[model samples]
Target: MAGTQSYVDDLSGTLDERLIISSTPQRSNALSNKFSGVLSASYADSEIRDALHSLDENEIKNTAETRRRLRLNVQKQVIQRNGAVVQEYGHVAEQLKRIGAIINSLTACCEVMRQHVTAARHENAPVLEEASSLLVQKQELETKKQLLDAFNKHFIMSEEDLLVLTGATEAVDDTFFGVLMRVKQIYVDCQVLLGTENQRLGLELMDQSSRNLNIGYQKLYRWIQKEFKTLNLESPQISSIIRRALRALAERPTLFQSCLDLFAETREHILTDAFYSALTGSSSGDNQNPVTKAIEFYAHEPLRYVGDMLAWTHSAAVSEREALESLFISDGDEISKGFKAGRQAEPWSAGDDEAFDGRKALGELVNRNLAGVARALRQRIEQVLQNHEDAVLLYKIANLVIFYRVTFIKLLGPDSSMLETLSSLVQSALRQFQTVVSDNASAIQAEIAAPTPDLRIPAFLDEALAQFTTLLKTYDSSLTAASSSVADFKSIISQALNPFLATCEKMAKETNEPSAGIFMTNCLIAAKTTLSAYDFVQDRVSELNEQLASLTSSLVEYQHAFFLHTSGLHPLLAALAPTEDTPGSLLNISTLPPFQLQPLTDAGQTLDDFLPSALMDAMENLKRLGNTKLSQEITADAAERFCEDFEFVEGKLTAADELREIALREGGEENEKEEQELVPLRSLFPRTSGEIRVLLS
Candidate 1:
């Protein structure tokens, strides 16, 4: 078996060499190319080795047979796969044929469809064009429908709205206001339409809206007028409905102004009637409740009567303004907007911007309301002023008128006719007061008598001051703010006190010296006491103090002279008087005849006697001074003057004594003889300045 296997191996080796190396080049190339994708030499060797290892021993021994059987199995599998591939290819061919048939049928159908489409296009050309036109029309119609719907929604007023706007009997409620507002908006929108390029519809709408707006404003104007005719200003509040109507009416400047005029006229009549009712006790409305008694009841008292009339007017003015405040001022912004809208609608109304100020409107209304009553008030007050003869009373009335002037200025503004009337009344009263005062002063001056023996102020001057006191008190008690500066009160002082005091002074000038001083002092003291209590009169008080000082100086001089005369020193002082033309030798008082030792001794005796009672006698001299304190001061001041005179005398006496001693020591016989004739200074005057001060003190 080994020999047989060896021979078979050799044979296999010989067959491999012949097949691989000895082949023709073309065959070898073909064989290599065929196997190149089939299996690599290394891979084939590895597979053969694995197969050999996997085989049992029996299979190894049967390797040749195994190889033959494996070859056959692989060939059979290849044949089966080939048959399967052939069958699959046949099925694929059948499917391709079926797809071709389907494609052919689709192509035929496409050809038919194309033919039909071409035929239709040729037959219906106008229809297609018409259909396209219809589509465009539909879109255009849709757009117009939308625009018309919006126009109807915004621009067209419903029947109900028109009725509310134009209904004559309709109340001026919020619905009326809303309808009016819509109509105005439509009118304004019409203006925008008028501005557009296509303005036919805009013109139609504008005409309709303008007519509706005019009717609406007419209705508002009429309604406001009717309401005003019935408005009771005694009530503090106004209705909101009226305010709404006024605000709406403000859109038509002419109509709004007309309404205000009618309202103001109605209020004027009402206030005038009420004034009469207050004055005549003719019962009106609840407004009469405040004035329980008629103004006529106070007619006996001029101040109270005129005061009541003015108070009533003021109260009525305030009430009327408050009631109408909401109708104008409270709706200022709304009214302004209304006016602005009107201006936009009517260009000519642009200047009506100033008309929207509620404050000014209210003031005008108040002034108009008080117009009729104001004239009557002024006439009556002036009548009362003219009838009264008392200057102080007339001044009080003037102050009353001034107080009302200020009050009305605050309530109705400074420009109101009521304030004008009050101002005129104030001037009238002041003029009459001055006239009455001048007449009274002239009468008193004409009836002037000698001052009383006691040097007291005369009865007429006292009466004048008492009236002045009342005047000052009236001014102080007034409602106006009192000015602290003295200049502010100078007019009143000049008018009330100064003229009367001047008359007193003129009369005093006709009297004797001391009596004139005393009486004038009394008058000044009375005036000062009256004015000193009021702060506004402090300047007058200071002036009176200065005048008093002047008079006191005069009294001091008088008292000093009295002292000199009482002490018998007047002649000595007269002798000692230095004449401007006196020669030098006689210039010395010792050389003068009155200063001789005998004359000095006699004057010294008189002064010594008078010193004990000098101050008392001086007090007696000025006893009529109304101010006792001033009298004592003048007496003391005079005593000081008396002491100064004694000091001067003592100085002269010492000088004369020194001259005499010098002559006795160093002079000739005649000089010594002259010195002996002159008395010693101690013997000449017994009184010293210190003793005089002690006595006076």
Candidate 2:
């Protein structure tokens, strides 16, 4: 596999907080369902402890060589530090030796005490002898020790040059509490030996220098986080530790991100509490608990309050505040998204037509997969009703409209009784429609009209319905909505009127200039007959559709019963039974066995095989019943053949008759002369045969 890498960068942008940029993802190890580390354990968490642990044993192991090296480095860092300490301490020891040597011969026991005193001075440590040991030695040197008020105090800013080289920093203390006050002598010695400073000042400078390493910790952590992503691991702790360090150091971007993350928890807590309380009839003010208060402060407080406190940890108010936030915030859950979708109404309908526009919101709702709404933002406001295939949106609309009507009417006061009546009637009317609208017209209308009239609805109902519509545009639309059914009636009337129009146009085109000779009375009768025929054909199509619908219902019931009866069918085939019979026939539908259609794509079942059983049965039965008609259709073809043959025979007869006349004429005078030889000119003029001869010799 190709190795992967990433760089996460935080850069200041239009927003105040620096934005972290994640490098484009590269192919990685498959995503693992590893549980994320939430840092429930202490000791600065998995990543921090892990990183600290990861330093090589040799790195952590402070051997004598390490200490020697660090001592050398410290010596190099402070000018004349080791030399000054060594020289200064040596002078004090020599002076103490001279004083002790002078008193040494005073007594044998005194000489031994002098030797012990000299040895203690030579070692650079403070000569803190236990009281018992001092007493034993003091008795021995009672006279000759010259009443040493305090053991000569000598300090050494001594440098052990090879300490760092021997890994002195990594040496584990053999006892507890070794890391704090019991620090390396080299660090202490370097502090004393360099420049002018007391012990307290030296400690302060050390503390100041150590904080710079924390910045490194933060940088290194982030670097590791990016690498983890490139490597395609589960939620790793490395990035979080990096963030934690930044937060600890009050890095602005990390601090804000930490707050933002905590905000989610706080928001959820508050919302959950509120939602629960809404059901429980508790007030929003019930957030008196420390946790609840923190959550509320985080969620609802002005941004400035959080900003100041987050800058530092000593800000007790913020610490308490953050602690409280971590306790109980919850992001709100979406119970319902009041999306409005309406039915496709007739073009002429005066009420409302189904339409939706999401050009802006389209980017949102389509992405959401109808899983209600996203928790991050309000579901969003769509200007038009949403149109989806779900029939529930329609029923939901009717229910909603009922709510609006009653609510608005009650808001209008005692006179609003009419609103209640209308609301109920409207709901009842909706239940009776043959075409079930699968959209949200009622939601759209109610959202638009609810606020305009302040009628008395049930207070609970009023609040709820109001809350539901809170996101709708505040401005009322200028368009006037008509409530009457005339528009719908007009659509019906058009359906009634089209056939007459088609007839008129066809007739107008066909009219030859009938000579004004045709009587007006007869023309009127024909006109009336044509109009009647057009009207009849229009009604016939409607009747046919109604009959098909009726048949569809029966077929549905039959198919349902059939599948129920064939319960013993293979489990796969049982699911293939007829369902949702539409008015049109699918008797010729072709399909593979439903079993073969697994993992479906755009391919639809062919019309021949996928026919619903009811439709197939209905088709076969219809064919069996129409056998007589089928027979008639067969003879109809024969009738066309007979007509063609008859026309041919008639043409031959006419040709034969003409040929006889032409042949006799062509025989010339021979055939005619035998009969006409005895005929006089006037006798030849007899024209009963429809022939006349005219000749001049």
Candidate 3:
């Protein structure tokens, strides 16, 4: 206890001295103030200690025990403070372990991150190389684009220049080949530059090129038209130029077609216009007949020109056909092979050959043109026949129609309608001729029937007959040339002449005078002579001769009747006939006195005057019948018999008294009582009795 007190006192003294030494006065004062109370208490404890020391030993033991107890409490507090420090140390150790684990985990994560980054870099290496290559390619494409842009500009410029040079523009030039070459080059270049990758652009460029080519071709066509217009079609130079132009365009189908169309149009215009003018006679400065000129022009120049053009067209078609065949073969089509085999198998017929040969197209053109010309000529001829009364012209026109029909048939084949038109024209002309003949026959008939019949009737009749014969002759030739039957021509002529002859007969009947008979007979004889001259009309003339013979027989009969009436023999004959009262008895000339016969001088004179000049002429005609050979032999014999009868009548007149005495003797009673009946002529006059006795004796 004493030691603890001493330690405590020493600790306090050390603390007081340290305070005095380290502390400022203010600090010492604050410390002194703070300890003041402690010091006072200590002083009191010292006083108490002194008093305890002085009082009793028991108080000293108690102070020691209190020190011991305070020491124990201090020990206990120190132990508690050490225990808290130990716990803090353990917590700090756990914290260090946890921080070490977190660091290890962070290190592992960093390592994994590094490995992934390395793999990514490895995978991206080829991509970066590809990107670098792409950059190079982009640069190249940009350069190429710039080049293509320049090429496009140059190509467009070239196309424009080609258009200008080819006269697609307003500038006209003769550099067609050069322009075509340049345009072709530009087109090929554009195709190359556009490439297959830019197929759409390439197609557009090709279309533009094709349009430009078409424009160039059109310009060439216009140039050809202008040049051709300046040249005469008939000139040799024109043909040469045409050939050259055709050759130039031959390779170009579209341009060639354009030229061909132009040619066709021009040809049609020229031919149609010329034909119309010729047909209408509106053409200028020509002396020849329009029909002739039309025929000549159509038959020659237009035909030749059309033929040439058709030949060219046919050649072009052949070339096109060949090209198509090749294309079809390349395409593996069976049609071309089959068509070729068929063509080889069946050779064309002559007409088919001609049609298929280069001439078919030309034939069509010529046929159409000629048909038009034929129609025009036919119309003109019809007009002429209608307006003009010229028989000669009608005959000529008829012949022309026949000729044209034949020509058209030969040139245009039988299918052509022009043949029908020609046939119609021929018929019309024939009808006109028939009308003319009828009218002329009527006029002649009227003249013959006039009161004082024209002496020129025979002349007119001769002229008409001659004209008819001429027409018949012309028709015969024309009919033969036209492949018409002779029967047809004969029928036509008969139809025309029969009516005219009948009119003449009618006129003869109306007049009924001997002169009219003589006039008609003469006209008929002239007609018969004229008609008989032509072999075609021989039968008609023979028929007319028979009619004349019959008319002559009637005239002779009238003459016989007139002879009997004029001679006064009729009354004598009537008186001599058997009477009804006599029955079988003859005339009793014996009982009757001798009858005195009158001289009848006036009757003879009347008969003589009644014999007209026409009768004399008829007798003269009959007498001339002897010269007509076998055809008139019967009429000649009849005339001779009539003359003999006239002579017999004269002799009978002188023997009239003798003939009466003989008749009276024959009728006596002795002859009447005879058993055998006497014949009338035998009883009146004997067979030996002269012809004079039968009449005037």
Candidate 4:
């Protein structure tokens, strides 16, 4: 039992050793090579030693059996594992063969495919080339299609577009306008097409567009005419669409002018009807507005009648002009664009491409609209002026006409028929005014040529001047300050005012000396005062001033003469008169008999009596002077002249007294008698130049 146990143990150890040797190949190989003949080497030295120690001799002898059995077990394990490996290698070899067969078949198939492709290429060369050409053609066709589509969209207008543009039944709306713009664009773009190689298309399209554009403009022209016929000019807000339509129509000048003519005719009739309504109080048997009195009601008042007629005409003209302006000028930019397009289409429209002048056209239309009323206005005013006898009223009518003429000059240009008619009417009224003035002057010259006995302005002259003043007030208030040139205003003053002043002067000439001067002075003073308020009348006023100065000088001279004569100084003056042979030398009146001491003594007594009441007497003499200030001024001036004459008399007396003294000294008592009578120069005159100057001052 012990031996069997040891043998089992030994077998277990040997199996462990074999597993270790198999795990360590280098050690196992070295051990096998070095210890091949030794039993101890068959097993590991450690394994033999362990066996010897653990086993008895019987058990050790059984080690050989253990070894044999172990060998058998290892060989069987090797056989089993080798069988598995060989079976795996055989399966791999079968797979490699299958793979080789597949490669050969694939190579053969590839060669066959290559040969077939080569043959196909040789057989269908023309077809391949044809296919390539077809592809290029297809691409070109696609590009052409795209270009044709773009060209059709851009440069061509469809028939529907033309229908919208030129159809009379079509409403003038935004779509119609937009289509018109496109058509116009197409028309203008035809020029570009004309510059290309294909001018036929351009020419054809241009002709077609030209006809269509003409038709459209004609339709628009008729449309504008219809709108204008029913246009309410009094409305403040005009349609923007109508304004745009007119701007579009301006491209055709002839058509535009025709439309304007129609509009003008319509407006003329309307304004004429309105004016007639204002004048007669009714147009169609309807009473006029109560607020606006009919001009005919004031016919008895010619000035107010004519004024009302002109006022109504002017108001109507202004309203018409403003309506036309609103219609034309609101779309000025669009109008300019259309005008430029038309000029471009027809370069010969004018040599210059100036823009449409709205201002000038508006003036023409306004003038035309006022034409119907202008004749009536002129005839009515002229008839009133002719029948009126009051120069002032006729002058007022002329001024009213002039005021309207100036207003129409701005509203309807200077060359307008309305202005021309007003001008002729003004001439007619003025002619009538002048005729009345001349006739009045003729009658006044015959009847009231003599001034009043009190040296005042004649009643006829006063009435004429009052009428003249009325004319002046009318003139000054009726026109603007800048309206008339100095020459023209002077002409007006000459016609209306100068005749009365001239008649006054003529009447003044028929009166006596101081009275004539006073009357003329009164007339001139009144004229200057009435006219001085106006700046344009200054020239005539200056002339009047010159005449007044002349008349004042004459009156002063006459008064001075009267003062010298009344003061008993004339004898002294005759004594002191400058000698003709001596040119400037005074007469030696001391030696003259009149300047002798007795005569000088008598002159002194007379001078003493006149000096006491000199200024009062002068005032009484010229008391008929109308202006009191002028009377005082003239009286003082004459008193001073009287003082001058008295001084001369005193000087002659002193000279005579000196002569007397010389005679008395030379021939003792020969002139003593005369010297005693002279009583010295101061005592005889007793009035010194200083005392006389004091009295005058």
Candidate 5:
């Protein structure tokens, strides 16, 4: 046992030591050259030691590294070889199994194919039993066919043979087929046997065509001589062509088709016109546009079907023929047909007669196709508008406007044109009148003749009216606001003058018109009256001049207020909010800002604006009034009266101010009845004209 263990240890030491020594490239190479000697030496022999002793430590380290790497590579190869062996074993098993299955499957397929082929072969073999019966049936059929063919080939009859058979000895228009039917009826009626006469009649009833209809009958006939040509008995196919040609001759064009084709296109237009007439019940036209004519048609319908009296009458304005002509007829045959077809055709669906409910279908409308036509019309109009322009444009627009206003309005309904209906009616009437008279040469002198609108007077009127109304509103509002200010000032003065006047005489004297007062009244009145009468459209075009007076007075007041506020003279006002400026204004009056009234001298620079000039003018008028009063000996009297009047006005104003302030602060206006009890001022004043009675104090 010890010896065995020692050998094992020695073997391990030999491998370890050999591996370390052969680590370097030189030592490895040396080992490889002596490989046979080293391997051949016994495990216990020292010859292996002699080979290893040739290696150094560095060499040993390299040899050991190489051996470590080589051992790992050897381990990997052993693993891969084992894996390959396992995979091959699995592959062999699978292939063997698959081969067995293929053989078994082929055996099954061959058996199936053999059974199918055998069954097919058995099914193909003819059977004697069915053949016998089939032969019998075929022979029987051939015998019958031969008999029929013989009868077809030889059949013939003469005219005389038909007299007794058909019971028609005289000539008749009745057909031979009809005569045959009569003979058959005789058999049905009598149920009796007759001799050759009965047979003759049946033969005769076979008809004239029946004689030629026989097979080979033409070949037997002498009409071979009629053509004065040799018969083509060799080519039977030519005989079929002849037969077909005869049939073609028998079938001619239908009478209906021939008549209709002659009038197809013409019929369509005629039918279209007729349909339109049925829908509208009106006239044939010459060169009138279809749309225009359709529109005019409704007007004429009463005359067409209902007679001249009805035709003369119309649903529209009967005053003139042209008014009836301008109708708005939208050309949609579908809707038109639906509406009118009811009265003309079927009363309704589900009625007694099928023909009553018989209009073709909804398909005929072709809304898309009609829309295309309308689109084409629109494009044509646009082209004419673009190219011909001045001449065509005005004419087209006028005509269309006439149609819309006159014809369409009246046609749709009495109230259809109710929107601006009056305006439309008036415009249409005017247009028609103008068209009639304007185109004709005037017999009168030029000065007396009225000018008609060969132009679009109404359209221009509408556009101008729109602009005029807008501006007029703006001007009117401004004028109204300014008038309020002046009236308030005048009221204030009048009330002041009243307080100082104790008697009628004093009242008359105080109220006399100051030079400025007359002018102020006149200015205010001029503005109010003129603005009130303003017409936005054509009626009073000249009235625009009247607007200037109101504009002036209002502008004056606006300027005065602006002056007082902007110049720091008064507390409450600035340039009144300005209207936004735009171009083409008849007046640049819109851009002017309200001016601050500089004191008479401070404003001496330029009083081009309203307020300053107005104020100065009022002042000048007052000064002139004062000069007129200068001749009065009591110039002081006038001055005193002015002060008195001023003070009285001031008092009244103060009273009004206090009342307003009370209404705001404590609503004392509500307590007026309660305050009425506190009055004591009237008792203090004595009846005047007593010259200071001694007890005056």
Candidate 6:
């Protein structure tokens, strides 16, 4: 077996050599065939084995040497590659060092350049700024020069043009009077042009024009003073001429009238366009009434016309005062003559009549102007109140009235008849406000009365009270102005609430229901609470509180009495304790034995009939009254007392039953004795024989 195995191993080795040689292209085909032939040679088994052993030892030795040589070669190649890498890294390090030096040099140069640039900027900044400033100044000077030239070309006028424009002969005339006349004419022309321009231009532009004209007016005024001094004019003549000049220049009657007309038209437009349209929520094309328009105008813009009107009225008043003082001083005889002639019903002289007529004309002017305004304002107020029921609007109207009152007083002087007219209007409005308050109070009272005896608080009560509080606050100023008005308001409220209190009191007295009194108490408490919510009721708060307390106390008493009456104790107690003049009394028991038993039996019987029903009703009533512990205790006590009395009366009847039973058992022998024994019992019980028999059975 060893020999066969050896041979198989030799064959396998030969085949393996052939496969390896076949895979190698570099091996010669002759060498591969020679190895195959050697393997396949016919040789003894031992010889082949020996050859195989030698070949194995040689192959192992060659494989070990080849592996050692390959390891040496790999180590040499690794060392060479590591040396090359180290050399390349040194070169890269050297290049980086040089590049870093270059970067540092560039940084230093940039720093020096930045420092120089900063120095240059600092050195040039002021010169650049100065040059810019000079250029701006030069531009400004050029602009001003252009504006001056334009102004000169446009506004500077020659003497002839000035004369033509101002209706003056010459601005610098030879004579002082002529110069004064020229200046006056110039002032007059400026005033006329200003008025014309004011009407055509807007308010801002007109303001500018007025400023320019004011300078001219000042010059004219100064020139007049100079001319008056030069001419050596008297004070009276200077005053007269100056007054004429000022009147002619400043008080342009036609222009003033035109301004008034414009004011009226503007007021009308505002009323129609803005105020009435917003107030009534309707377009006021043409159908709106003059009264409504006037009201809305005042309501919306109460101060719109006040300033202008006051100015005009003040000017007119000053003029009137001057004229009147002059007339009184200069024409006193003429006025006296006119008055005398009028008293005699004869025509006055021309001077007297003319003076009287002038006074009349001025008076008419003031009166008619103020009357129209006052009448229109009063009608507007009426229309406002009629159209709207706002208490706040009433206050607004009152405020407007006060403003007008003060304004008109100032305008017409407090003693003018116009003040009386305004006072009447204010009074009328106050009366209307009072009426509204009274009406509202009446309405609230009616609401309070409408609920049944149950007095369920009306749902509208809260809303009504809220409205009342608002109304009071709105008119608090007016109401507090006079104690009388406050009193009147209090009276109205009392009148309104009185009926409610009276009704409650009447119901409380008439009804046996405790709920009636409770309802009344609640109503009074509610009324008090509602009234207390209002601050304007401060004056009446104490009085109202007292009234509420009294009413509540009375209602409480009624409630307690009704509670007692429901239990039937009130009537029973009244009967038991009769007064001196009353005959029937339970205390009279000893004087009449017969009547004593009758009273007890009658009282017991009445209680039996009513106690149960009263107890049930009382239970229900107390339950309705909130089921308080006191009510429960009262009911229990009443029931216990009634039951005890019933049981006592039953026991007395039972004793009488036993007595009759004994008498019947003894027959005629014990009858007389039993009768004598029963005498007192009979008086106490008052029972008949049949009743006794029935009771005994």
User: How far does residue 378 in candidate 5 sit from its true spot (Å)?
Assistant: 6.7
Candidate no. 4 TM-score? 0.75
lDDT of 2 by residue, 118-189 (tens): 887777344455666788787878854543332111121113312312222422222211222123322444
lDDT computed for candidate 1: 0.78
User: After superposition, which runs of candidate 4 have C-alpha atoms over 4 Å from their true positions?
Assistant: 1-105, 124-168, 192-198, 234-236, 284-293, 298-300, 346-348, 409-416, 482-488, 532-536, 578-591, 596-601, 608-615, 666-697
Q: What overall lDDT, based on C-alpha atoms, would model 6 receive against the true structure?
A: 0.49
Clashing pairs counted in every model: 0, 59, 4, 0, 15, 0
Q: How close is candidate 3 to the true structure, as a TM-score?
A: 0.43
Best-to-worst ranking by lDDT: 1, 4, 3, 6, 5, 2
Provide TM-scores for the models. Answer: 0.82, 0.17, 0.43, 0.75, 0.19, 0.35
Q: How far in Å is the alpha carbon of 36 misplaced in model 4?
A: 46
Q: How far does residue 60 in candidate 2 sit from its true spot (Å)?
A: 99
RMSD in angstroms, all models? Answer: 8.2, 43.4, 32.4, 11.8, 33.4, 29.2
Candidate 4 lDDT over residue span 1-697, tens digit each: 4665566567667866876667655665655654444434444468766655544442435756665685575577679989999999999999999999999999999999999999999999999999999999999999999999998997777878878888889989898889888878888888899999979999998898888888888888888889988988888867877888888887876676688788889988888888888887787557556776677877667777887788788888877777768765666666767777666555667565677666776687788888888877777777777777988888887888888888888778899999889989988887887788788777765765577778776676678678877876776787756545456667667766677677777777786788888888988888888888877678888999999999888888887887788778887677666533231232244456665668768987887788778778877867887788988887777777777777776666566556556656776676667556645655655678898888667
Q: Quick one: best TM-score, which candidate?
A: 1
lDDT of 3: 0.53
538-611: candidate 1 lDDT, tens digit per residue = 87799999998898888778878888888887886676555332333233556677666787788888888888
If both were scored by lDDT, which would come out higher, candidate 1 or candidate 2? 1
Best by lDDT: 1
Model with the higher TM-score, candidate 2 or 3: 3
Q: What's the candidate order when arranged by decreasing TM-score?
A: 1, 4, 3, 6, 5, 2
lDDT of 6 at 25: 78
User: What is residue 606's positional error in candidate 1, in angstroms?
Assistant: 2.0
Expressed as tens digits, the lDDT of each residue in 270-360 for candidate 3 is 4445555543345544544534444334434332322332233233323333322222222322332333333332344112222122233
